[model samples]
Target chain A: MKPTPTPDFDKNHPDRAAANLATHAHALFAIASEHIDSDTLRRLRAARSDALSAPRRRNLLPVLVPAGALAAAVLALAVVWHPLHAPSTAPATAGTGAMLVSADSSEVDMAQNLDFYDWLATQPQPASAASAQ
Target chain B: MNLAAVPQHSEGLVAARAPELPVTLETFLAQVQRRAFRVAEMGLGNVDDALDAVQDAMLRLHQHYRQHPAQEWSPLFWGILRRRITDLQRRRKVRSIVVGWLGSVGDDGEGGPVWEPADPLADPAREIAGRAAYADLARAVRALPRRQREAFMLRVLEGLDVADTARAMGCSDGSVKTHLSRAMEALRHKLEDWK
Candidate 1:
């Protein structure tokens, strides 16, 4: 004999289905919670602490060398250019022709003015009356 | 020299400034680690790989948490973890391709087959019937589309509310509801035997 096909209970009783589902879900959750391992919990605690502390000690070694080199190059250029570009120490000695002669010394001459030489060199040259041979 | 005097002033200024900020990575990890592990495990279907994904996600979170907002940390962490799991899936696919190309290596044959975890609640006639029903339910859940699976896990397993689940999943609450509804329908069909 052909068995009567089961009615679609979900159509007639949605609330009943939902309540059962919720109950089953709650039971599943309770079971799953019991299986939570203490070791896993400890490991999780460690991972979190590591995550927080790791940034404080973060050393991006991959980028450090290139960044350091670039910074050093910039700093060296600044050091070299600073004295040469600064305003001269005294205005009275500004136009003296001896400034350029002393500018070649590698040793820093605190008393001598490299800026005066730089200023002097930057000035527009006089229109030469005679052509150079 | 004034230059020598400048160092002291700078040092004093630094001391007077606020202390280094205490990042809450540890605290956040304590809250999310287990759920993250479970989510990863469900997504990848491998405990060791899931653990690795969780660790990698935690490390990445640590790396970025300083710049990330305090309130958005949970969502941001979950997003990073999801990405890590995706990466792991891609890597597994590549490994499979490589293995297939290489004609495969011999298994170590040491460890036993994938151990079936016996449901502790699987006993007695009523419980046995429940177990079979639950098995069908689990299979239905496992068969869900990726987004639906994620939505269900976030909303149901993690017990996150709709707004929070939406934030974590990077979707609207409506999307969460849609995914959840589809998941529920699929499970309901599979779980009809439970009636």
Candidate 2:
């Protein structure tokens, strides 16, 4: 007599067949786990710890970096705007011109040429006279 | 300098963000490490290679994708492991091919088979039938082709859903199904007496 054909238990269901195979495969996998003995397991754990620690250390940089940038930006804004607004109570010796000269070295050259500018102011009627005529 | 003096970084924020971060990652890696190593062993057929693959995968996942949501960790880590295992498998294949070529030159019976592992089942040692059968199963699974092994491990052993397995293996759902079916059929045939 002919035997009956087995039903398609795994048909239309991939994981079913996979599950069956896994069921069969699990025992050997367990044995294989045993083969991954203590020393190996320890190393694997150490590897995990090593791997874990690296990212945490790396993560510190990102946190520190953005915060550091924010602080630097805030400090810079304060330094720049501090003398600009000056609370109207800054020392008279620390005049805005002197502050500008300190803030920009180019202003030192302008300040140093102030005497020349004053002499020129007393002597510069040539161009204005020609234009007036 | 004063930036260093006050320490501009938010110590509180760092403490808040960091404490929770690696805990989940470490848990995930710890949970999966053994099984991942097992799967790699199945693929590579050697403990060292398998552990290397596992460690590389772990490092890659931690270094690259730790910030992904916890739920996404499974697929991402598996995906990385899949790639690492595949890469190592390819490199092994190339090395074996070169070795085979060199061996073929002498054409002597000196070197044994390069692919097949030693039969641990040969020595029974009064072990249980289940253990012996498991040895056979591991050998059989290792004997399977690379794609079939990957499909089997991911879809079956790892219990990833088809979509997740597909994502992990970098293949289409249909391809995953096909490979998994072929793997199951092959394993069933090879391990017919296990039941």
Q: State every prediction's TM-score relative to the real structure.
A: 0.53, 0.58
For candidate 2, what is the DockQ-based docking class?
Answer: incorrect
Give lDDT tens digits, candidate 1, residues A1-133.
Answer: 3322221223244455544453454344333433456665566666666665664546577699899999999999999998788877555556443564656555336336567878988987776824442
> Poorest 10 consecutive residues of model 1 chain B by lDDT?
B1-10
**What lDDT is reached at residue A26 by model 2?**
49
Query: How well is each residue in B87-147 modelled by candidate 1, as lDDT tens digits?
Result: 8878877766765545445365443323333342232113222334333444566567878
Summarize candidate 2's per-residue lDDT along A1-133 as a digit string, tens digits.
Answer: 3322221233243445444445545434543454556776898998887787774325577899999999999999999998888766567546856666656677777776878988998985788788999
Model 2 spans > 4 angstroms off: A1-20, A27-35, A55-133, B1-23, B103-129
The lDDT of model 2 is: 0.67
TM-score of 1: 0.53
Residue A70, model 2: Cα distance from true site in angstroms: 23
Mark the 10 consecutive residues where model 2 chain B has the least summed lDDT. Answer: B1-10
